[model samples]
Target: MIPELDGATWHKSTYSGNSGGCVERGILPTGRQAVRDTKDRERGALLFGPSAWQAFVNAVRDGEFGG
Candidate 1:
């Protein structure tokens, strides 16, 4: 189960400036990663472990998400 999330400093992707489809991210105290919709920060967020987060970042760098 995801742990309690509070006081996390959420940051949005650099490419998400002024774009309607923007995603925000944050780092958890446990070194895990957190992601949420920039349009709705008060809602729920998706959590990812360090390894998973790294992999996703790499994938994005490789244009795996159809950048």
Candidate 2:
């Protein structure tokens, strides 16, 4: 089934805690990744190219950004 182009496709991180601070991710029709703050949906999302998104994910997995 074709995914919805709207906000319906956005999803929260499985690792997100109960804390109010969180973000959602979505895959755009352009194959780019979109990230937006959960607290403010109208604020829009930050789009990332596939490679950039992969690099960011890899960095996170590698613990490049200290928790």
Candidate 3:
């Protein structure tokens, strides 16, 4: 289980609107990224190392996962 999440600042995408259908992102103390469902904050999160997170973001930007 990851630690230090209590102090992590969480935020959703600006494009998320108010549909309550997006995940929130947090930057962990170790510079890793954590993602959790916006509608279920207490359910823990998916943690990713910096490189993996960047790769995922790049893939999203490139439409690798398809919209």
Which run of 10 residues does model 3 get worst, by summed lDDT? 13-22
**Which regions of candidate 2 are displaced past 4 Å?**
1-8
What candidate 1 gets wrong by more than 4 Å, as runs, is 1-3
Task: Report lDDT (Cα) of residue 52, candidate 2.
Answer: 97
Q: Whole-model lDDT, candidate 3? A: 0.84
Q: Which pairs of residues clash in candidate 1, taking residues 3 or more apart in a chain or in different chains?
A: none
Rank candidates by lDDT, best first: 3, 1, 2
Q: Native-vs-model 2 lDDT?
A: 0.79
Return the top candidate by TM-score: 3
Q: Please, what is the TM-score per model?
A: 0.80, 0.78, 0.82
- lDDT of candidate 2 over 1-67, digit per residue (tens): 2233463468897777898879889887778888878888777777789999999889989999998
Off by over 4 Å in 3: none
lDDT of 3 by residue, 1-67 (tens): 4567877888896667776678889988888898888887788998889999999889989999876
Clashing pairs in 3: none
* Candidate 1 lDDT over residue span 1-67, tens digit each: 3445685777888878765988988877778888888888778788889889999889989999895
